[model samples]
Target chain A: MVPPDERSRALVSVLGTAETKVTFEDPRSIPEMVLAVVEAALEDAALGWHDIDAVVTASVDLFDGLTASSIAVTEVVGAVMKPETRIAADGLAAAVHAVHQIMAGAYRRILVVAHGKASMAPYWDLTAWAMDPIFLQPLGVNFLTFAGLQAAMLARHDPHAVSRWATTAALRRSAATGGIAGPISVDRVMASPVVASPLRAGMCAPVGDGACAVILGDPNIGDRNLGEEDVRIAGIGHDVGPHHLMIGELTDWAGLRRASQRAYTLAGVTKPTFAIVEPSCLFPHEEELFVEAVGIGTTAPHSPGGGLFAGTAPVISGLSRLLRVVRALKGRTGERGLAHGTWGPAGQGQVVVVAETP
Target chain B: MILESTIRLPFSYAAGTVGSRFLIALREDQKILGARCTSCSTVTAPPRPFCSSCSRTVTELVEVGPDGTLEAWTNQPGNGVFGLILLDGADTPIVHRILGTINPGTVNAEAINMTPGARVTAMFAKDRTGRITDIEGFIVEQDDP
Candidate 1:
């Protein structure tokens, strides 16, 4: 449903999701992981390295513990002589940026690569550095503690909040395929040791190392013979809330609501209806916020692929959700699907992408 | 095979004009300063250079309360109690540790007597550096009859 002028700029289509593995231990270097995903992506797209016009990557220098971390993967992504952009945030944001470049007629084909390895160092320790040094850093607050704060606030509002979170965690983990975490029960979830009060260890997503790459191209530049399995990016939108957690309402995700509204408007979807929805919810409470912000009623099918609850790399979680949605649409699981990604403390950054079968 | 190595990277961080001023206030006068945005009439604690809500430069500096209300709190496993405190004159809350001998990690509501909306007063450390840790933490303020 992209407008006429925009449609000609580039008909952005997702070629495929490539080589994503969730594991606590990946015996591969950062560049090796990048190469693996890039190779897999090219093979799935039925194209060679020469076909890619530009590259966009997502990785945090802090997480990688290197300066200009993207430099390590540039050669593998086939960006030695081409234009490459790096997003220090989540991978879904990088993909959305790639969509803009194609729509602006900058390039016909753009390859998006995102990678994260939680095994590199203390993940939470690095995250603490992202906080306001003067105020937050001294308190030793990290993403997990922030999540705990949000969960406690939500618990104050709803009496059965902890129980609901436990159930959601159990269901998502059970539905996960190729997940590092096995199926867990609600009782086990409740009995699990508390990471943050009101949020048990079982309710948190398993963080691991993984990489994902997707090749997108203008429909005209690619093969003329189109197939029913191809999926097109119908709409995309992203938003960043205040950097400080105290600035916004802790209970609701206003940023996601804004992002999803923009995407829905571009996709010309007046109703909150979808065949499938995949949200990068690192915690069960976050899934509740996503559903409320996106205005998807309780009946809508959500995260059939298990979402982040299964096991997701920190920075790669969002883009991986997109991969799941694309695969679902291609497999005839849904005609229209929604994928959501988030970053920063307490969902400060949000992105929504709407994909539909061609 | 499993391989492990430690890599240490050294770097220095600069706290700009706004941050420097906040630190100076704490070091010299033991005062908490916040910036007030005239456009939005919002006061942000620890003073940011710009008003996030209005997207305008905030030049007016105001001294907020040594007393505040706890908005939310959590007890870290090894660490002590931490809470988001809404200072008396500021619109935004500041995250800090709660100072007390009683550990909220193991105590219940009745034992700790700390909950959301509880009144607390800032307690400064004896050895003050121009850092955020100058104010050690907040303690429960007893009500006067």
Candidate 2:
């Protein structure tokens, strides 16, 4: 894992990024969603489907309720005859895998699209089914339960934790102008119905339907419209934590911390600072955990524009975080940033990407 | 109109050699089994053939607790309380339901202690089946709080 820096000149660039506004429920189907983002991303990159050498998609069979979930978007993603790889986890993971293709000198351009419709079914039940059917599943518990467990553990020590988490949720929701999750005052948040003990509905990111698409291209070889402030992926890192919540450290995102260390190593920088940082924190407490894990002091413009509290699709949350970082860095060029993504109960899985202006 | 349909696929999972023995011990003798990894010296309840930490095979099955300490627990609405119990002689905690009069109607706070490090014992179901549920749930043998 070498940083795509001086040692490796064949680095991957974010040619384009586009995503539909995360909503309570998208009226369009998966294919239509793919088509919309594909067109917008292609337009942004100044390229067409023919320019993309391969397609890497992020979707899950269980999430889509369709076997081989990628089949639905095959035509729209322009993967008719080209090579395609599907990642069943977070959307950012798909981009991480696609970067490998470019770094290996295989593909010049790869289109990464991740879509999810949380409105399709009861999302928590699906996550519960993802657990070990032997022990955890029969208990009828899901990710929310784990979050509650973790929160209770955290709050047990810190008397002010629940109130602080409520304030964090209210602040994020108020900043979340995307309209996916309506804003609520701190008092209202405190009064919000509990989804699980300690974790109220107001504290959770209102998951809904949305899709995110990004175009990753070999910066060295392509009719690349080399923009001066273009933000390219300098380093990529991902780690899978132990599946059992009991076995792993629950209070902090140890997996994300490890992934960031790997990324910082690959980026060739030991002590790093960023102008922007985006974390795929589905819950408010997670934002605090991610901030502490990465050691990025909470003062930076972290998760500008409300982060996941603005509303985001599950599988695409991490990739969506990357999109936010890319979009943010585009305006304020020549600055470093990090994007984080996590999956499974209590952040048992994590991925991080370090991006910077070239 | 939104299309709504349920996708159902009935399936059965074969708990491999280690898991089978662990379940069988509970069914036949009311004994709890755990595997100690030779390489890592880590004990895993609801034993797996392979150690999750070191990826090395743990074939030595040892009789583990009918008692353990509650590492953590949560009260999931609509679902009863669940806890991660670190059985005596095991490093990893096993997640299971908390048994006792926990039904909301009779949920005696004093009877059901949810604090971490609370001592509990495995209670076997009278009607034993070869499943994790064979042990109805862990009872509060000694409430820490």
Top-DockQ candidate index: 1
Backbone collision count in every prediction? 0, 0
Query: Residue pairs in steric clash, candidate 1?
Result: none
Candidate lDDT scores, in order, read 0.82, 0.82
RMSD in order of candidates: 3.3, 3.0
Question: Worst lDDT window (10 residues) for model 2 chain A?
Answer: A1-10
Docking class of 1: medium
Worst 10 residues of 1 chain A by lDDT: A1-10
Q: After superposition, how far is residue A24 of candidate 2 from its true place, in Å?
A: 1.3
Candidate 2 at residue B106, lDDT?
A: 43
Summarize candidate 2's per-residue lDDT along A162-245 as a digit string, tens digits: 789899888888888856878888888889888876788888888999999999988787455657667788788898887777
DockQ scores for all the models shown? 0.56, 0.54
* Residue A24 in model 2: lDDT: 83
